[model samples]
Structure formats: C-alpha cells, structure tokens
Target: MTAGTGLIPVHKTDNINKLKSLFPALVHYGNSDMLPMHMPGHKRRADFMGGIGKYDITEIDGFDDLHHPGGILKEAMAAAADLYESDVTYFLVNGSTCGILAAIAAVTKPREKILIVRNCHKAVINAVTLRELDPVYVYPKKCGSLGVTGSVDPEEIRQALAKEKDIRAVVMTSPTYEGVASDIAAIAVLAHNRGIPLIVDAAHGAHFRFGADFPAAALDCGADLVVESLHKTLPSLTQTALLHVKSTLVDDGEVAHQLQIFQSSSPSYLLLASITQCLALMAQDGAKMMATYSENLCSLRQALDRLATVTLLRQETGFFDYDPGKIVFGVEGYGGRDIAALLQSDFHVETEMAAPRYLLAMTSVCDTKETLLRFQTALSRLCHGLPPRKAVSFPNMETVAAEKVMTPAAVRERTWAKRDFRESSHCVAAENLYLYPPGTPLVVAGERISPEIITAIQAYVEMGFMVHGVNDRQLFVVSENMSG
Candidate 1:
C-alpha cells in the first residue's frame, strides 16, 4: 500500500477480507435514511482513486454538520436515542472525557457546589477544575480482601445532598472502573426530590441496556445526563462516544452550547461513520450478541472461581449490581501489577485495568471462546507458579475521616507544581494525584496531606505502578511553590 495526496493503493484482497472478518460489524454497507449528498462528498462512493478510503469524506452540502446537526446527523442521533430509550442523544467525536467536561460545564456555574464520588475518573477532576465547581466528596465503599474501591452508598449521597443544600447537581460513576454499580435509581430520586439533577458517568455502560446480565442504564434510572464511551464496551472506534440528555432538568440550549464549546471543530468523518455503523449493528443484533458475551463471561468467571489462589470479586455484597463483561480477579499472593505484567509477558494477554489487589479483564461481543480459554489457562498457570500471597497493609478507614476542606472551585484557583515527596510533607497539593489503571486519587488539591497518603504514594512507586500528575522517581509530593 502506498499513500499520496488523499489516494492509496490496495495490494491484497486477502488483507481486506481478514480485516473485515475480524470486525464483522463494519463489513457491509447499505443505503437507508442517510442521504449522501451533504457534507460527505463521497456519496458513499467506494472507489477513491486517491490514497483515502471510501468513507473519508468531508462536510459539504446536504449532509448535516456535526456541530450544528439538523439534517441527517440529527436523524441518526434520534435513532440512537430511541435505541437507548433516552430523550435526546448526541454523538461525541472525542472520547467520554469531552462528554464529561461538557456535561459538567452545562449544568453548574462557576464555583458552584456539586456532589461527586471520590473514586471518579481523572476526567471528572479536570471537569470540576474547568467549570470552577466545588465538589463535596463522597467516599466509596472499600473491599478489604481485594484492596479495591467499590460503589458508593445511596445514603452517602443523600447525606451530602442534605448537608450541602446548595448543591446544584450530583455526579456519580455507575459500573465503576471495577465494574461495581451503585443504586442509581435511588440516587436519582433523592437528587430529583431535592430539585437537583443527577449526572452519571456511564462511560463503561454503553452496552448495559442491551445486555441481560448488566445493570439497568443510568438513563433508565432517571439520571438527567449520561455519558457513554462506545469504544470501551461496544464495537466502535476509539474516541467515539455518546452524550445523552433525558428530561427537563437541564435546558437543551445550554447543553448544546456546552457541547459546541468542548467538541472539536474538525471532527473525523471516519469516527462519525464508525459510530453510525456501530449504532446500526446494535439496533440489528445487539441483544443476541450481548447474550452470547454474557454466557462466555459467566463461564470464565465460574472457571476462575475454582482456582484456590484466585478470588473473583462478586457484585452482590458491596455492589448493588455488576457488569458481567468486566472480569475482576483477586490473586491472593501477587500484586495486581505483577499479575498483569506476568499475563502480558508470559501469556500475551493484556488486562484492561489493574490495582494493588485486583486485575480487570473487559470482555466484549468481539471476545471468542478461545480467548477466554487462553486467559483461563494462563491464569491457572500463574497461580500454580506464584509464591504464597502476602498480606497487604491498607490504611484503616476509621482513622481516615472524610474531609470537605476546599470546594472544587477553590481547588481550581490553586496552581499545581511537582515537588519532591520527601521534602514537601506539609505543603498543600494543587492537583489530584492517583495511581492509574484504577484511577482513584489518594490526595486532592487544597487538602492537607495525611501520612496515609504519603505512605500510599511510596508503596505505589515501589511497586512500579504509573502515578498520574506526579513525576518523581521516589515519591510525588505537592509543593507550595506554584509560580512555575
């Protein structure tokens, strides 16, 4: 294959066939309600003499624009909303990160108070900062045996809403990074009764509504706004996501304005086409595909359950419900990072997420029985080859009182700079420092650092885990010197 001015040559038809076979969702193209005379000048033309593929067209005439969609793009979004059973839906060219930012920006004002679960993604923290919103932290339940963060109690959200009467909205992560889900219905009811809207970060729950084993979607539970990352659990390309608006809590104009502000002007036509394709596929055979995926996931979990060294985390105890596709296993003797590394190096299987005690595997409709069997074989081998498990010392929850010191707005005003952990003990942090994979922050901006946080930071570094927003080899500490 050669690349030139928007033209390329295909040398082999087998390569194209193999690619299509790998992703059956993209193999066929059909004409339906979408008119090809608009922005995409290709008119569904397959023969692009240049290097570009057939779908690589730009906004031109009859094809409605993405930013201001009132034509074909709008119709596609409406169809997607109907499939998801939401009031309105918008295609997100950027990842869920952009949708998150836009949703937060749309509902709250500068420096306004909002309630957020502490175990949120880093994107939430960035949204809080960008919108200058204050966040009242709600600590999620902790799993002792797995050393993993679980879902937040609805009572905790109720308490925060009661205490902070001025809270404009509540932001939550359902089917969390660990695949743990909260009682979104209860939370939504509480927020609505208090005249506030609930915005759910459903980035990992794009297929929840289509699957039998998955928990009910955030929108189904009365959340005002929900963001879904289609690429995470669905058969869409990377950076393709959806932002949904349900009822009247938020104005449509405000939501549209915020989306326009956050979204890219030069959106990729390839990504948009992929979204359309994935949506159509889902509408056609999503339920059947998800049912098969669920069976595979359950079988894999059952097989893993038989292993003595590996303990699978169940959703009934700490979590209200769970997404079956997310396979989280707890190895008794090995750190999650070590187990993940071992799986990658020895078995050539890469896990989705890893923490101190838990390793996560995300199964999609694309996953095959062979893939699951391979993973099982590798995990059993690893269990037999590993040494005795060590007892990890986690900080006691009683000693760590949940503190609401600075609001999200206050945290945003502060500047962030990297400082030596050894030298900057008493200094305040201007950023949320966390270990990746799980993406839970031990320390937030403007809060006094506890010895517990310092110890966690050191432990994470020694374990060779990637810590975000910090660069020190030994330790990552926040500095008072913010001039730089």
Candidate 2:
C-alpha cells in the first residue's frame, strides 16, 4: 500500500472490452439472446433485465448438475483447480457458508473439539453449533487505537494445540475482515504436526491469488481446506464461491458428501457460469488487470494519506500483514459509522462496512481509475477545514470471556427459556450474540455469559449498534426445567 506522489497511475484504454467468447452459459441461451419464456417467471421481458431471466437456469440436459457435475460443470471446476493450484476445487453457488460447514463436518464428528480463532465469521459459529463441536477459542490481538480486532497470532495457535487434546480440526480467518492476515504458513504447520486439518475461511481473499501484492491465498500456504467467496473481492455475482482442498489430511470424498447435504439440490446455473467466466478472465487477463488495479489503489491511498486528521492502517500499525485492497481509514475523533453516513448522504457513496473506529472501502480490479480518484476527491472536500469530533474509543473486548458449560450441540437440545438482559449473567446461553461487519461472536451457544460480557453487550446496544440474539431486552438461556 504505497502513499504520497509515489502512487502508481493507471493508463486507461477505450478499446479494452470484456471477452465475450468465455461465457458458456450465455452461449447455452441460443441465438435469440432475447429468447425467453423460461421457468424463472420473469416472462422474458428485455426491459425487465436485458434478458437475464433467460440465463437463470437449472440442471437441464446439457447445462450440468451441481451435485453430480460431469460435463461442462466438471470442466469448469477442473479449470478452477488448475488456476488456484489446488488438488481439486468445487464451485460453490451457496457462498462460503456451505464450504465452511462441509469442511468442518467432513473432518470432525459430533462432540469432538476444534481450535478456532475467536475472530472468525458467524458462519463458523453456526457450523460449531450444527456439528455439536467443542470449541477452544483463541482471541486475536486487538488494535489499541479503536479497540478493533487484528490478525491471529501463530504462537497462540501453537499454545492452544499444546494444551488441548483430542482436537479434530483447526479453523482461522486469514486476511480478516479488517484485512489483517495471520501467518498461515506457520499456522498450517502447527495444525499438520498435530495430525489435524486446518480450515481457513478465506472468504474475503478471492482476489489474493491474482498477485503477490495481496497476501497469498490459504490454499497456497498449505491449508488443508480453504474457502473463498468471489463476490466479496472479485467481479462474480453474489453467492459465488470456491472451496479448495490442498493437503491429504482432508478427505475429498467427505467434502463432496457434506456439500451435497449442505448446498441446495437445485443450484443456479447463472452463478456457475459467472464463476467460470470470471476464472477465464482472471486466468487470461489477471496479471495485467491486477497491475492496473494496484496502480489505481496506490493513487487512492496516496491521496488519502495527505489527510491531516485521517489515518490509513498499514503494516507499521502492529499488524502481521495487511491487504491493500481493503482501505480501512479512521478519523481522529468521529466514529466510523458517522464517517460512513457522511459519505453516503453528502457524497452519495456507500462503503462496504464500518465499525466504531474504521470504515472499509473494498477496492477491486473492476474499479476504474476515475472511481478511485473520485473517492479521494470526496475525502479531501469532506476533511477540508472540518473540526474533529470528540476523541472516543471503545474498550478492547478480549476480557469479555465466558465459561463452557457444554458443547454447542448439547446446548442446542436444551429446551431454551427467556430471561431479562440484566439477570442473564452466569446463565448458559441458548443463542449467539454478536455484531455484523466483523461477525465474531461476543457470546455463543452453550457458554456461561459473565457480567463483563453482559456489560459489553449493553454498552454496544446503548451506542445504537445492532446486537443479535436479544429479543426485546431479553435473551435465551438454558431452561432450568430441562434435563442435563
């Protein structure tokens, strides 16, 4: 992430057009590109979509099946595997949720333990609940400036593995939502030495494989199972993702079996086709495309660096490593959401996500140089002669600890009852409480919530932050009448 006048400038060319020949699904729609009257119920109105309803297909004769891919779908998956350098890669229309769930279920059984970085997405929590797994949580190093979370410490994983016995798997999110990347190579070695597969939720890292300017993909770093959601950082349609199997520790057959159960029986052909076309574009044009993207990002960062009261997060900020594609900027005094609203209402630019301390702008290869410049220009105008808001920082949440009363699966079966928020302390939780953006849980199912945890939850609520799992100032806890 370069700054100052050293920003690499992108040279745009008008003749550059999207490669039209790569889309097989679009080709399957036949000559009439306007041919409609399909099953999607859009009724083939060109004005409704430009004939997108024609592309929304199911597993028809030659289109290929998601559960049993044999023809074009198999070829597409094979191409993706080769491109990603994985032993095998599956096309996931169900997003990274299906991949994470399948990867966890394939490698572990009910009641087994998995060591996971605490900053993982809520999807991991859902998986832990469904599999009834025991979790050993390792918290990340929190950023002190705004109390936001940072990358996982490889040493933390080593210590957790040494202390925990009968561990079936290890899971962590590399290049976290804040763009902090842990030492995947070191973490993978730690898990491999213990004969446990490491599952990396690289959902925000789909564009990582395009260049070394970004952190290396978890698959390239020896992770047994890695999941990437292309929609997050790539040009694919929403819900498109890929699951890569690298090490021999993960059973490929089991991954397939679990995917069959987890994903929809009828997957969307449009998403699959988009994945294929995206892979082809990246495979053929990614090197040049990424170079242009980095150039634009560098220009944006350079302009952003000139702001007096705003700070751009970088490697010198005590992070292990960072992804430049994620622009996490903080104001001297204002909250991130305030800055976000300012941009939205005044500048009409909606950002990806914002925390108390930072607002995230997800730059992609598809963003033009003009868009990047416009963002920088907006910042300059917004910051010029503006007074700083009051300096306010939330407390680091590492101390909000909970005790394990039972496995998440065990908690799922306990007939749940409601209790008022204030009296919920020391009670086993029947639900997970967390905030979005960085969806790591403040509390998960089957844990005994502490007074500190309750205080943090209340404080977040008072701050006007949305805290899931509380229904009208009440929470679900293990019913006292239920059998142990």
Candidate 3:
C-alpha cells in the first residue's frame, strides 16, 4: 500500500468551489500512487500525526513552496488577494506575529522612526526590538466604564506625522482585543500625506471583510500593509494568517525577504491546507454565514440588554466603531475575573478574556444560534444571582503612557534586577510588563516605571489579572548600579 492508504478517506464533494487550489493539490498528492520519499519523515503515514499526517507534506513536487510560491500556492495566494481586493497577498503559516514583524521590517530601516499606536500587541514591540526601530507613541482614546482603549484619533496621527518629520513608517492595531476600531481611512490618509506607509495589525479583525455588519478591513481603508490572522475570527487552524501588500510605498521583494527571515523554512502544509479550505469556504458562503451570525449577535445583545446589573458594551460616543462579534459584559461591584470564573466553573462556558471591569466573549460565524443562546442564559443566571458589592473604579490606563528612557534594544544590553512590582516605582524597566490577554505593554522595556504604573499593576493583580513578564510579583528593572 502507498503511504497512508489505509487511512479513512476524507469525504468528497462534487460541487465546484470558489478559490480552490492548494487544498485540492495537497489532497491529490496525498491520495496518489507515488512512492513515499519526502522530507516530511512521516511520508504521509497516519501513525503518529493522526489523520493529519496524510496531508502534512514538505516542499515536494507539485505542492509548491510557501516562500517561493510559483505553482498551486501562487494560484491560492492570488485568489486570496482577489477576495481581499489586495494587490498581492501571501499566506502566513507562522501567524500574524511573523506577518507583523515582516511588514514592519520591510517598510522601515534599522534605527528609523516608526510611529506606533501605544496599545499595540506585544508582537509590534518585538518587531521594534528586532529591527531596532525607534518608535514614537500615539495612544488610543479611552471609552466606556470597561477601561478598554478605543480608537486612535486621526488627528493624533496627523499631529505625530507632522511633528516627526524623520518617521519612516506608521503602524497601528485596528479592532483591539476589546473590539474597538480606529478610523483607518483617515489615519491612512494622514500617514500617506507624509509619504509614510501605514501598516495595520488587523489580526483580530480578519472577518471584517466578510460582512457589512463588521468594521471595514484595513486594506480597504487604504493601509499600505495589512496583516490578518485567519484563525482569530475565521474557521481556520491556529497560526494561519495573511499578509497583504496594497500600495507602491511598500517593496514586495523586501516584504518577501523579511517573511523568509521571520517565518519557518519548513512551513506546515497542513496549516496551508487549512488556510486554503477556510478561504474557499469564505469565498463561497461567507457572506450568508456572516449575515446569520450578525443577526444572532444582535438577538443575543438584545437579551443581554434586559439584565439589570450586567451591561453589554456597544458603540458609544467617542468610539469610531466597534466590532459586534466581541461580547464585552460588565457587572458593577464584580471583577471581570469573577464573572469569567463563574462562567467557566458554574456554566462550563469559557470566555475569550477578562479585564478589571469587564469580561470578553468572542463569537465567530462558526458559533451557532444554540451556542449564543446558551451564553446568553449563562449571563442572565450569573447576573441575577450576584448581589451588588463595593465596586473599585478602573484606572484610566489610556492616559498613563510610561516614560520612555531608552530604546528596547538599548535596554537589552543593561543589567536587570527583579524587584517587587510595588517597590519597582521610578525604576527603568528591563522587560515588558502587561496583561496577558491583550499583551499591550503597560511599561515596555527601556521605560521608566512610575508609581501610576505600579498602582495599575497592583490593581490588575488584585483583581486576578495575569501580568506577563512578572516573576513572583517581581518586575525586571535596570539594576541599581545602572539606574543613572
């Protein structure tokens, strides 16, 4: 028997599909009579990798390489570009992390200034550190009682661009972890006026293009480079993402080169197949699915609105626009951790994330009406059962931009000491410290740790939030001798 011939066959569909290329090619190779001699030592065997081994291929003949896509992979990427209306799109098996890194590196040279939205994902910070780019900050506006950051004002971008004449590129995250989106069209215009290319880390907003109910995709909003995680809001395997290049300002060759640097050489064909399948499904039936999903979310919101203590956060004044899929619920007098724990322990429903004042539940087109109703019922039960207790006001973290003492690269060369987070006041941090779910650094490396930052960390810790980069409640700061 050929390698994995004994495995149960995947079901076949006769109907013609849209954006169909890579998946079919992989499957064809898997079921062929060819002998087993490939780099993937599994050799299409379903022994250890389960059924996935059958399609888990390497850069074999006809499969086409991810880095140098000239065959089926090229066609698949082209189809995705068409679907997304980008000039060119590349599949990212390494997820949005590599995409963000590649995009930032492609557009800016080392030590060049790149204006960054301060509340960006930690990957952006990593990109700045890796490329050694000098980052100028533009913090997002605060909205609502949840203390979640809102959109970056276009005016702020305009001001930063006008002030920082040496800035090479601009980077921002749209539809933050809490689902608030910036005015990308306006911001893109502001960046372009200064001849700077805008790179939007739209990892959480991948589904925006699939439905009218969602915010506009950053690519369509005129961003030069847009990186999206297909897995975040779509039905794709984890670590699958897409990087789109739409403007002449960004060099496609440079982007490809940087992606080769950041992404693994042996990209997983299984993940590629997952991306192909997801895109095909989206191209075919995504609009209908998104419509139904939007309707269900609305109904769920209406049900949630009836709760006396529980409040569902929606688009309010000062917020540009919010993604409907992010379900943020807040109950007075209760920490978000408590709500999330009750949902997990009592109702068996795990939420996406929890902050000081609010718990976030992420919904996608994959969620069914039954699932939404169950979540709604769980919230209703929890909200009714809990009594009103003393509430702690959430600090306005949006206003607390840490003092930048040095570049992240410079901080890496210094001696570090671990100090109790509370006692670490006024010390320059040697590492990033931020909440885990959002991963936005409250105090990035090379920044002075102020008392306000310490208080914020203590508050989050007291409310049971996971603080990353802290060991045993100790934060890494520049050693006392190096403090000068």
Candidate 4:
C-alpha cells in the first residue's frame, strides 16, 4: 500500500518502507472512529472543504503539541535536523518572518549592534525594529546590467566586523529571490572568528540540500543559525519554515524559547502534516526528483541560450554562485514588465516577478518538462516578436541606498503623516517602501529619503511595476514634531 493521501502523487516504490513522518499518523487518526471534542470546530467533517477538513486537526493525544513537543512532533523536527545536518531544528508554522524575528531576538540584547546586508528581506528590518537592535549595514555587490543586488562580499563582512566592535551577530540572505548566492562559508568563518553568530535567511534555499547542482546550504556552510522556507523551494504547504542551529555560539534553548513567543500556539496540523509529507518524500526520493528537475532545467537553459535578444542570467562575476532553478531573462530594449505582460496576455503564463531589467520564473521540483517547455516556447516567441533593441529609461537603482537618520524602533513609534513623494526629499520615511516580489526595502523607516528615491519610485510605477508603501503618490514621512 502507498502512504501519500494528499494532492502530491508519490510514485516511487522505494519510498513505501522509507516514509517516516507525522502525515501517515494524521491519516490514521482522521480515519478512526474517534469523535472530536477538540478546539477545531470542524470536528473531522470531510464535507466542509473537500477532504482537507478530515486531516485538519488540533494537538490531540499522540499528535503532540507544537510548543512543548515531546513525542511525534519532536521526532519530526529531529528528522529534519538530521536531514539538514543541524544540531537543533524547530518547525515554524508562522513562516520565515517569525523565525527571523525570533532568531534575531534570541541572539542579541536590546540596542546591541548587528551587521545586516542591505538587500536583506523586510523581515530582517522588522526583526531589528522588534528587538530594538542597532543595525550596521553591509551592501551586496550589484549586477550592473540587471540592476539587481547580488552576493554579499566576504571582504565587506570582514571590514564591518573589524569596524563594529560591539556587533554580536551577522545576518544575511543567501540565494536571493533572484537566486544569487553569497559565499556563506567564508562569511561564516569571519563571524565565528569574532565570536559573533552568523544568521542566514536562506528562505529560498530549502532545496539546496537535495541537489548538488544547487548552491550549498547555509547549515553546511557553518552558519550559527539558519532559517529556511520549506514551501519556497520544497514541496510543502505555504508558511512552512524551519530554523536550524549549528554552533555553540548560539543557544539552541534560547532559540526554542524565542520560537515559543513568536510561533503560533495553535499550529495547524494540516500544515505540519504537509511538512511531514514533504520531508518524507524528500528523504525517500529526493535524489531522483532533483535529477529529473535538473535535467528539465538544463534543457530549458540550453533552449533559452539560443535566443539572440533575451539574456538568461546564469553565472556572473559578482555573486559566489547562482541557482539554476531561477530562470531570469531580460532584453536590453524591453523592460521586464513589458515581457511579463506579454507572457500573461499572449501566452497565458505567469512569472514570479517582473523587475525593471528582468522577469523571474521560479521553478521547483514539481515543475514538469511540459510546463517548462511551454514557458520556453512563450519566451522564444516573445523574443522573436519584440522590436529591435533600443535603450529604455529605467530607475537609477544606486539612489536606493538611503541614509539612516533614526533607529527603526524609534521611528516606528513616532507620529507620521503622508506626504507627496516629490516633495518628501530629505524627509524621514515612516514606513517600508519596496518592490513586493523581492521585499528588500527601498527606504526603511528612519532613512532620509533622497530625490533619487522619489524619481525611482515614479519610474517603477510608470513601468507598470507595483511599488509598495506608496499611497496614491503619497509616502509616509515622520511628522516634524516627532523628529528626535
């Protein structure tokens, strides 16, 4: 008999005996005659929303509690730790956001300095604000043509550590949304030498362990604390994430304690079961799955490489490495938005993100050759149809590096007013403004807004890209009287 009873079909016969996760237990409990008097009001009613309600359960007897796990849940996390080779692992149902918040809070005291990459996700900024930590910025090398931030240089981390004596932790994102990975091993060494814990937001790198073609996982790269979004690159339910502790420099107990404060009390069993099923499948058949996936990706890349105008981003000079799964393509004459629109309207294909210079097509292990072929076909047609290459006006991305005037924590609580972006030059921004797909803030709160920022925002908006934190051409700026 086969184990999987969910949406994903498991065909590998070898996985029959190897499957070890909480998912089968959930199915058994769901099938049992046991009546429910638990917190979930659904009460195992399969008719509520298909058969999903049957598996959606609360922390019942053998299922174990997520917060104070001692039984099945604990073992499940341990299996994940063993798979990822981490000393300790915790399942995060609240997504990587909660993990980032907890990891930052656990490591440093209030107002303690931490070095953070400028191109880090918004969650990193939120963690700094929540923990009231002082953040010193380290910027990533830029891919000049694409206008996208690439790898964080190890030299930058070394220089920052030498300069900031009080820095307790170093935080960065590897395998950026566009799949640009940094040299995590070298960065980890620099931080460990200073006795500072290295925390990596590897949200897009959950699948790195499965394939040799992918860049190295941060857990294997000597990071003290690493957070991965299983749902991002792996076959798991949305919001499923994992936090791993690798070194003695980090207190695993404190991370567990912080998770208690940040993670949800009533964790969704359906999501946990999804995580279990994902882990089990990967444990059993991951090598085969990745092999097939890599083959398909390679074929698509070969086809894409033949296109004259559209350029596929593979290996570049600045980043340590690149993930082949992220299919980023762009032409000099046409904006990413232009190509994205054509893909949607003409080909009925949707991409992950449309940047000013490139459109991102995110692929996972689930992407079949047929689907990839369809995308390749669409892109090739679009490439042939696009007008001859000519320069198009794009944002001057260098202006995004705004100067910080106040701490994020201080500015977050201050009174604020919405002002026009055009006249808000030199004003302290009260809210995070960023492009949604890649949520690196253009201007975090406390940063003095530059005219170039205003210009960039307008250009992004004009190019048919969504710029968050703008309310009908207005931006939230700290009120004059609230200035410290």
Error at 234, model 4, angstroms: 1.0
lDDT of 4: 0.85
Q: Rate the local accuracy (lDDT) of all candidates.
A: 0.74, 0.80, 0.85, 0.85
Return the TM-score for candidate 2, rounded to 2 decimals.
Answer: 0.91
Q: Rank candidates, TM-score, best first.
A: 4, 3, 2, 1
List where candidate 2 sits over 4 angstroms from the true fold. Answer: 2-24, 27-51
Task: Compose the digit string of candidate 1's lDDT tens values, residues 1-484.
Answer: 0011111112323312222111222223222334556444555555655525444555545546898888667777877777776778889998988999999889899989889888888888888888777788888877635655667899998888888889998999987877778888999999999988899999998888777667888888889999999999899999999999997898867888998888888777678877887877766677778777778877888889899988787665676777767788878867677889999999898999877767888888888888888988999998888888575654343224335456545655556555676555666666667777556566676666666666666776776776775675433333455442
Clashes of each: 15, 0, 0, 0
TM-score of each: 0.85, 0.91, 0.93, 0.94
- Note the residue pairs that clash in candidate 3: none
Who wins the TM-score comparison? Answer: 4
Off by over 4 Å in 1: 1-54, 387-418, 473-484
lDDT of candidate 2?
0.80
Give the per-residue lDDT of model 3 (tens digit) for 1-484. 0011011112222222346846777788889887877677877776766767887788888788899988878878888887787888999999999999999999988999989999899999999999898889988877775667888889888888889889998999998888888889998888888888999999998888877778888898899999999999999999999999999898999999999999999999889989989988887778788879888988999899899787788887667888888999888788788889999999999999887788899999999999999999998998888877767677655557778989998888789888999898898899988778778888889989888888778877776677898877987888868644
Name the candidate, 1 or 2, with the larger lDDT value. Answer: 2
Native-to-model Cα distance after best TM-score fit, residue 109 in candidate 1, in Å: 1.3
